[model samples]
Target chain A: MRSDKQSRTPMGLKIAAGLGLAFLHLPLLLIFLYAFTTEDKSYQFPPPGLTLKWFAVTWNRPDVWEALGLSVRVASISTVVALVLGTLCAAAVSQTRFFGRETISLLVILPIALPGIITGISLRSAFNLAEIPFSFWTIVLGHATFCVVVVYNNAVARFRRVSGSLIEASMDLGADGFQTFRHVILPNIGTALLAGGMLAFALSFDEVIVTTFTAGQQATLPIWMLEELVRPRQRPVTNVVAMVVVLVTFLPILAAYYLTRDGDQISGQGK
Target chain B: MPHAVTFQKVSRHFGSVRAVDAVDLEVEAGEFFAMLGPSGSGKTTCLRLIAGFEQPTSGHIEIFGETAEGVPPYRRNVNTVFQDYALFPHLNVADNVAYGQMIRGVGKAERLRDAEAALEMVKLPGYGARKPGELSGGQRQRVALARALVNKPKVLLLDEPLGALDLKLREQMQEELKTLQKALGITFVFVTHDQGEALSMADRIAVFNHGKIMQTGTPEEIYRRPKTRFVADFVGSSNVLSPAFTRRLGGPAEWASLRPEDIRIGAEGGHEARVTGSSFLGNATRLTLDMAGEKLTVLLPAGSAVPAPGASVRFSWEPSALHLMGTET
Candidate 1:
C-alpha cells in the first residue's frame, strides 16, 4: 500500500534512509552469515568455508535446551501476568475518573521510562530487603514490571479510541454490564489487547538487564548467550542460537505493529 | 388503561446545570409522540430518562403503569433506536438484530428466524448476512429499527434516528415509520430538533426549551394555536403581530400569532401594505409585506398574482386567524 506521495519522496532522502537501514542491519546480516561458517576457533568476516555443523551442535546441547526452556517459560508467564494487569489498568485509566488518575498512569509507565539498570538495582534491593530468594519467579516478576508497561501503552491507546456511545448503545439494546463488555467493549478492544500481549511477550523474551539482577543461579536464553559470549564455547553455535532469538522476538513485534497500525478504525465505523 | 409512558415531575441536573427541569409528560398507548426542541433543550435528556440511561434527580417515571425506578434499560420493556444506529460492527445484520434475544438465552434457530422476520418487517429481507459497514445510511437505519423492534417491546424510543439521512430519505422513512407504528400498535417516543419532522410524523409533540416544556399538543393544535412566543416562532412559519404593530394596523389584540396562509394577497381585504419582497415557491408565493414598516409574511396560494416590490396591496385576515397570546403564553 505504498502511496503516490511516498513513491515521490526525494531521491536524496530515500538514499539516506537506505544507508541508515544498511548501517543498522549489517551486523544482523553478519550474524546470519556466520551461523553457517565452518570456523570454530577464530572469527573472520566471510568465514573460510561454510558448514551446517553449528545448527546441529546448538540443537544437541542440553545446556542450550534448558536455557531456551527457561526463557520461554519466563516470557510466557510474564506476558500472561502483564496482559491481565495491563488491560485492567488501561480500562480503569481510560474509562473512569478518580483522584490521582494521571499520577497513577504515570507511575504505571515509570518502570519502562527509567534506565533498565536502575530498575534492576531497585528490584534487586527490594527483593533483598524482603528476604526473597532469586529464582525463576523473581526473573518473571522483574520482566513483568516492564512488560506491563508495553501492554499498557498499547491497550490504553486502543481503549481510548473506542466510542463510549457504543457501550451505552449496547446497554440500551438490552445488555447488562458484563454482557455489554463481552459483546460490545471486548469486540472493539480485542485486537488491541492481542497486539499488546504480543508486544509484551516479545519484550519479555529478549529481556537481559533486569534478568541480571533478579535471576540468581538460573540462565535465561539471553543470559546463556551473554555467558557463552564471554566463555566462547563453540562460538558459531552461539551465532546459531542468536538467529533463533532474533526470529522468536521479531515475528511477534512484526505482528503487533500490523495489528495496531489499522486499529484506529474499529469494527462498524464508516461504510 | 395505563398510558404507555408517564413522567411525574421528573428533573435531572448535572452539577448546577439543569438538563431536565420538572417535566410532566404522558404518552397514550400506541401514540406517535415526538419530543421536539433545540440542542440543550432537555428533550434528549427526557428520552434518556425513559430509557433508564439516566435516572431522574427527583420524581418518578412510569412505563405502562409500572414505576421505572431502579430499573435498568435491559430490564425495561422498551428498546431505543440510537441516533448513530450503534450497530455492532463485529456482527452481521442477523446477529445484530438477534442480540437482545441472544441476551435472553433464546436458541439460535428461533432468534435467527425472528431476526429475519424483523428485517422483513423493515422491508430489508435477505439482508441478514451483510455487514452494517456495507449498507447505506438508510439501510443502516432500517437495520437499527429491526434490531430494536425484534424484541417486541411495548414502547419504542428513537432519538433522532433518521437525522443522518438526506432530506428525501428522511421524508420516506417518516412515512414508513408512521405506517409501521400503526401496524404494530406500539407506542413510539421520538426525539428530534427538526420541527418539520415532528409535524409530519408525530401524533402529538412536546416542544421543549431551556429544560422546560413550552407546550404539548397535536401537530395542528400546536401549530395553529401556539400558546407561547417560543412555540409560535419554533413550531413553524408564523408572523407574530405584536401589540404596538397591531395598534398601527388598528387591530384589537396585544400579542397574537398570524399564520402566513391566513393573510390573503389579493382578496380585497381591509388593510393596505407595500410588498417589500417575495420568493416564488413551486406551489405558492411567499410574499414579504411591510405593513407600515412592520414586516409580515403572506403565503399566497398558486395562480395568485405575485406583486412586485414597492407594489401597494390590500390584505387582511378573519378574526378567527388572530390567536392571542395572554400572560400564560
Candidate 2:
C-alpha cells in the first residue's frame, strides 16, 4: 500500500528540476552537436548541416597534436604532483593538531575558493617577482596549486570518515607505524585518493585560465583554441578538437564520479 | 609473580578535564580484570593508557615489570578488541585475522593457517572468505576477537568489545568470553560500564568514578562490602542508610549500605515501617518501605505474603548484614 505522498510527482517540482538540469547541461550538449556540424564559419542554431568531416580535419592538424601533447603532459605531471602533496597534507591536517592547523588548512584550500582569474593573475605576478620564466614547469606548478586543493578536499573527508580506533587497533596488534598505515589507513583511503587524483587530472587537462598566464610559448589545447578562435582558422577544426577535449576530460570525471558514489561506505561498516 | 599491568599515580588530562586522574592500580597476570564505571569515569582512559592510545599526564605504568613509559603500542605485547570491534573493512575475515602475522613478515600460507585456528577458537571457523560486512554483529565481534587472539599477546585489552551487541547477544558473549579467558590463561583487561557484566565475567572488579577508582576487589567482596557510598549505590540497588540513621543504629561509619536481600520483613522483626510500594520481580518480590521517613528496599521471596501499600510492616537485619562506608559529595 502506498501513502498519498509516496507516489505523486508534483508538476512544479518536475518542471523546475528539468529547467535546472537544462540550464546547467544544455551548453555542453550544444558543444557536442557543433562538433559534428558542417558549418565552418558561423554557428547555426540547428547546426544547419551535420558531417563527419571535422573528425578527419582534426586528425591531420600538427598544431592540434602539439597543443594536445602539451596539455596531456602538463595535466599528467600536475596530477601526480598533486596526489603526493595533497595526500600528505591531508594526513598531517587530519591526524595531528598543532598551532595554526586550521589556518594551514584554510590556506591550502584558498586557491580553489578564490576565482580562477585571481589565482592566475597572482601566480603570474609571483612568477614575475621571482623572475621565474613562464614555461612548461611554470604551467604545471600553477595547475598543481588548485589540483592539490581538489585532492585535499577528497582525501581529508575520507580520512575523517575512517575510524581512529582501527589505527589504534592495528598498532595494538603489534603493527608498527608504517605497517599500520600500509595494512589499515591505505586501504581505507585508497578509493578516495583515486577519485581525488582522477578529478584533479580532469581539472588540469582542461585548465585554461591559469595556463594562459603561466604558458609563455607553450600552446596547450585550450591556448591553441583561443588562438584559433581569434585568427579564425577553419573554425570547425577547433570545434572538432573541442570534441576530443570533451571525451578526454569526460572519462576521468566519469571514473571519479563512480569511485566516490559509494566511497562513503567502508567494506565492514554497512552491514 | 609479577603483575600483568600496573599504573602508579597515573593521570591523563585533556586540556582542563582530567580524563584519568592520579590513581594507582595493578592487575595480576592471567587474571580477568574488569574496570567498571559510568561514562566519564576514566575507566576507558585507563584502558587507552594500557593500550598506548593515550599517555599519562604524570606518574608511571609498567607492563609485566617493564616500564611502559616510552614504548609504543606495537612494541608492547598487548592486543585489543576495540569497543566497535575495529575490524579492517577492506579485508575479508581470513585476511583481517592474518594481519598481525603479515606485519611480522610471516608467509601467507602460515598466517592463514593461524588465522583459521584463531577463528576456530572464537567458534567462527570456516567463515574466513566472507567479508566483515557480510557477518552479523555477533559474528563480526568474534572476528575481532579472533584477529586480536591470533597475535597471542601476553595480555588482551578489550574496551567494551561487546558494547555494540544486542542485549541477548551481549549476555551470550559474556559467558563465552569468561570460558575463553579461563581456557587461554592470558591476562584479560575488560572495561565496561555495566556492573552486572563486570560481576558475571571478571575475576576481580575495579569500580571507578570521577577518574578515580572507588573500590577494587573480587566481585563478591565488591557486592558484599562496598567501601564507599558511591560503590554501594553504583554497584547495585542498595538501601543506603543516612548518616544520622547510621549513627543512631550504632554503626561505626558515617553511612551504612545494605542489600535488599539482607533485610528481614516479618512481624517478629524489631524495625517498623510503612509499605509504600510492592512489585513482583519473577523470582523475588521487592517492597519499598518508608521507615522513619527514609525509604528502604526489602526483597521478599516470590511466594511470601504480598505487602499492600500503606500497611505497617516490621523489618530487621542482622548487625553483620550492614556494610559501613565513608561519606561522599
Candidate 3:
C-alpha cells in the first residue's frame, strides 16, 4: 500500500514554497509581460493592449545591434582570458604547496567577493595611471578581473576533488608530464572548466558598473538599455532588449547548473 | 645477475620524522620479496622509493644496476599495484589495462589484445567494457594487477594490494599472486602490515620497526628464529621471554623467543602454570597461561583435551625451541 502520510508534503510548506518562488521570479515575469505590451510610454498592469510590434522594432534598430555585438565580443574575449588564467591559478594553488599559497588563492577570489563598483573604480584608476587608452580591450580587461574569479572558484573546487593517485598512476604507467595531463587531468576537470567558462560569460554579459568605468564611449547592451530607460523612447523596445538579455544570460547559467549538479559522481570517487 | 633493486644506506626523512632511515636492502631477481611492518614503520615509504615516487634524503639506490636517485617514475622500468587499486575511474577495464602500452606508442589493436590477455591472466577476461567503479573490490584489484602486468615491467611493486579484501578473497588472491609471480619470473616487491600475508606469500620477508629493518630472512627463518624482540612480537604472536625468565627456564641470561605452537601441555617435569583464559580457534584451541608472573600462550590441537579456565597445567617445549637472540635494540 502507498504511504500517503509520509509521501505527501504538508500543505503549509507547499504554499510557503510557492510564495517564495513567486516573490523571487515575479519581477522577471513582469519584464516578459511588458515586452509584449502595446503601450510603450508607461507600464499598465493588465495591459491596455498587447501586440508583436516591439519585437519587430527591436529587430531593426542598428544601435541595439551595435550594443549587442560589443557585449558579445567583450564577454567572449573576457571568458577566454579568464579560462587560461583561472585554470592555471587553480592548478598551481590546488596541486602544490608554497609560501602564501592560501593568500594567493584568496586574492584570486577577492575580485568577485568585493562590490562591483569597488573593482570598477580601482580598475579605472589603474588603467589611467598606466596611460592606457580606454578601448574594447580595456572593457575586456575589467570583465576578466572578476570573470577569472568565477572560473577559479569552479576550477579550484574540481581540482581539489580529483584524487592525486590518478596522476601518479598515469605516470607509473609510463606517461610523461604532458601525456599524463592530457590523458588523465584534462578528462577529470574538463566539465568543470566548461561550466566555469559558461558562468563567466554570463556574468560578463550583464555587467554594467565595470564596463561604465572601463569603456570610454562604448555602449554595451546593458549601458544602452540604461540610457534608454532614463530617456523614454519607445520604452517597450527597451523591455524587448531586456527580454533578450534575460534569455541570453539565463541559458548559460542553466546549462552550468546541470553540468555541475552530479559532478561528485565522477568515476572512482570513493574507490 | 645484478639484484633487481638495491638500497645503500638510504634514508628518506619528512622533516623530523624519519620515514625510512639509513636502510640497506636488496631484492634478488625473480623472487617475491615482502616488506612487513606496522603502520608508520616505513614499509610504504620503501615501496615509494623503489617506484621513484620519492627520492632518498641521503642514500644511493640502484634498479637493475641503473642509478635510480633522480629518475622519474615514467623512466623507470617498474610498475606498481597500489593499496587502493588506483584504477583509472574514468576509463573502462580494457582502456585502463591498456594504459601502459598506449604510452609506449603501441598500436591500439595490439594493446587491446594484450590488455585482454592480461585480463585473462588475472581471470577477469572479457571485462574490458566495464568501468572500475562497477567492479567489486576483488575484481578491481585484479584489474589493477592486469594493468601493471600488461607493461611487462621487470620489477612489480605491490603496496598492500590485498589489504582491502575480506579473509576468503584475500587468501585466494594470495595464492594466485604467488603463482603469477612464479610464472612470470619477475621480481615482486610487496609491502604489507599483515604478518600472515607476509609469511604465506613472500619468498623472503623483511620485518620493519621504527624506520629500520628488524630482521630479514626467509619466512621459515623469521617464524622459527626471530632476531629481536620486535620481530618476535610482531610476526606471529610468539612469546617473548625476558632475560630473567629465560635464565629461570634453564636458558642463558638473554632475550629469547618461544613459538606458541611449540609449547606442549601436560608434559612431565616442565613449568607449572595456571590457565587464565581459553578459546576455541577452529583448527586449534589457544590457552593463555600465567607461570610465575610471566604470561605464556599455548596452542592446543583442535581435537585435544582443552583445560578449563583457572586449571593448573604443566607446559614445556624442547630445548631447541627456545631461540636466543642478541641485545640489539
Candidate 4:
C-alpha cells in the first residue's frame, strides 16, 4: 500500500512540473513572437504580419555588433578571473579551521546578497577617488565582484560535500599534496566548477546596473539594450538582440542544471 | 622482529577533552595488530596520529625505526583504508588503483600492470571500468583496498573498514582481509569498535577505554584473563560475581569473573543458588540464577532441562575457571 502511494506521488509531481515549465517559457515565447512580427511601433498581440526583417537589420548594425563583442569580452574576462579567485578562496576556506573563518566567508559572499546598485555606487566612488578611467576593465571588475560569489558558493558546497577522509586516504596512499589535489579533489569538484563558471558567465553577460556605473564610453549588450529601450530607433533590432542574449544565457543555465543534478549523488556515495 | 610502528606516551587533546590520552604501543613487523575501542575511545585518533593526519600533544611516534615527528602522511610509507572505504567517486576502479603508483612516478605500463594485479588479488579482475558508485558496498571496499595495496606501503591502516557493511558481508570481508594480510606479509594496524572483529582477526589486540589503553594481549588472554574490570566486561560476556568470602577458594579476593559457559548446573557444587529465569538459546539455555542475594547468569547446554523459576539449584565450576581480581591492587 505504501509503495503504491509512493509511486503515485512522482506522477502528480510530474504534472505540476509540466505546468510550471509552461508558465516560465510562455513569456519568452511571447518575446520571440514579437521579434518576428513586422509591426515596429507597438507590442500588441496577434500582429497583422510576421517577417525576418529584424534579424537582418540587427546583423547589419555595426553598433549592435560592437556592443555584442564588448559584452562577450567583459563576460569572458570576468568569468575567468572570478573562477580562479573563487576556486582559490573556496579551497582555502573549506578544509582549514582558523579564527574569523565565518567572517571571511561572509565577506566573500556579501556582494551577491547586497543590492546591485550599492555595489555599483561603491565601485563608482572607488574608481572616482582613484581617478581611474572607466572602460572594459572597470566593467569586468564590477561584474567579477558579484560573479565571484556565485562561483565561490558552488565550489565551497562541492568542497564540503567531498569527504575529508578521501583526501586523507589519497595522501596515505603515497600521493603528495599536489598529486592528491590534482588527481582526487579536482576531478571530484570538476562539475561544480564548470557549472559555477557557466552561471557566472551568464550573469556577467547580462549585467546592467553595475556596468552602467563602471562603463564610461564602451557599452555592453545589457547597457546597449537599456539605451535602445529608452530612445527607440530600429527597435525591432533590439528585440532580435534580446532574443539572442536570452538563448545564449538560457543554454548555459540548462547545462549548469544538468551538471549539478548528479553532483550530490557522486559525493554522497562515499559518505 | 623489529617494531614497524611505535607510539610512546602519545596524547591528543581537542581543546579541554583528551581524545587520545598518553597511549604507548608497539606494532611489530608483519604483525596484524588491532586497536579495539568503542566510539569516543580514541582508536581512530591513534590511527590518524600514526598516519600523520594529526600531531600528538606530547611524546614520539616512530614508523619503521624512524621518528615520525615532522613527516606528513604522504611521506610516511603507510596507506589507509578509511571507515567509509573512501573510494574515489570520479575515477573508475582502474584509475583509482593507479593513483598511488602515478604519484610515485612509476612507469605507465608498470603502474597499469600492478593495478590490474592488485584488483585481481582483491577478486575483482574485470571491474576496472566500473565507477565506485556502480559497485556494491563490499566491492567498493575491495577497490579501496586495491587502491591502497597497489602502492605496497610498509604498513596498512584500516579504520573500521568493514563497519558500513551488513553482518554477513562484514564477516566475509574479515576473513578475506586476514588472508590478504598474511599473503602480503605487510604490517597492519586495524582499528575497530567490534570486539568480535578484533578477536577474530588480530594477532594482538589493544583494548582502549576513555582514550587510554586498558589492556593489550592475545584474544585468549584478553577473554580469559582480562586485567581490568573494563577489559573483562568489554571483551566478552562474563557474569561478574561479588562473592562474599566464605573462606576464599584460592586466595582472599573481593571480586571474581566467571564465564557463563564455565558454570555448570544440576550438580552438587560450590555455590548455592535459586534459578530465577531460563532462556532457551539455540545451542545453550541461558539461566539467570540468584546466588547469595546476587544475580548470576549461567549458560547450560540445550539438552539439559531448565529449572523452574523459583526452584533452588546448585552451581559449581572448576577451581581454575574462576578469574580472581585483587580487591585493592
Per-candidate Cα lDDT values, in order, are 0.89, 0.88, 0.91, 0.87
Candidate 1 per-residue lDDT over residues B209-229, each given as its tens digit? 999999999999999999888
Which prediction has more favorable lDDT, 1 or 4? Answer: 1
lDDT of 2 by residue, B180-222 (tens): 9999999999999999999999999999999999889999999
Candidate 4: which stretches are off by over 4 Å? Answer: A1-66, A88-113, A122-138, A216-218, A232-240, A247-271, B241-251
Question: Candidate 3's error at A203, in angstroms?
Answer: 0.9
Tens digit of lDDT per residue, candidate 4, span B256-302? 77788998876675667888998888999999997666777899887
Pitting candidate 1 against candidate 3, the one with the higher TM-score is 3
Better of 2 and 4 by DockQ: 2
For model 1 chain B, the run of ten residues with the poorest summed lDDT: B245-254
TM-score, model 2 to reference = 0.87
Q: Given candidate 3, what's the lDDT at residue B279?
A: 88
lDDT tens readout by residue for model 2, A1-271: 2543688877798899999999999988887888888777877788788899888888998999999999889989999999999999999999888999999999999999899899999999999999998899999999999999999998999888677788887898888888888889888888888888888888888788888888898889888888898765478788778877777678877876776666555543533
Better of 1 and 3 by DockQ: 3
DockQ of each: 0.53, 0.60, 0.58, 0.54
Pairs in steric clash, model 3: none
Highest DockQ, which number?
A: 2
* Full ranking by lDDT: 3, 1, 2, 4
Interface C-alpha RMSD after superposing true interface residues, each candidate, one decimal: 2.0, 1.8, 1.9, 2.1
**Model 3 lDDT per residue over B1-329, tens place:** 99999999999999899999999999999999999999999989999999999999999999999999999999999999988888877788999999999999999999999999999999998999988888999999999999999999999999999989999999999999999999999999999999999999999999999899989999999999899898998999899998888898889888999999999998568889999999889999999999878999999998999989999998888999999985543
Indicate the worst ten consecutive residues by lDDT in candidate 2 chain B: B245-254
Indicate the residue-level lDDT of B303 in model 2.
84
Q: Which is better, 2 or 4, measured by TM-score?
A: 2
Interface RMSD of predicted model 1: 2.0
* Docking level of model 2: medium
Q: Between candidates 2 and 3, name the one with more favorable DockQ.
A: 2
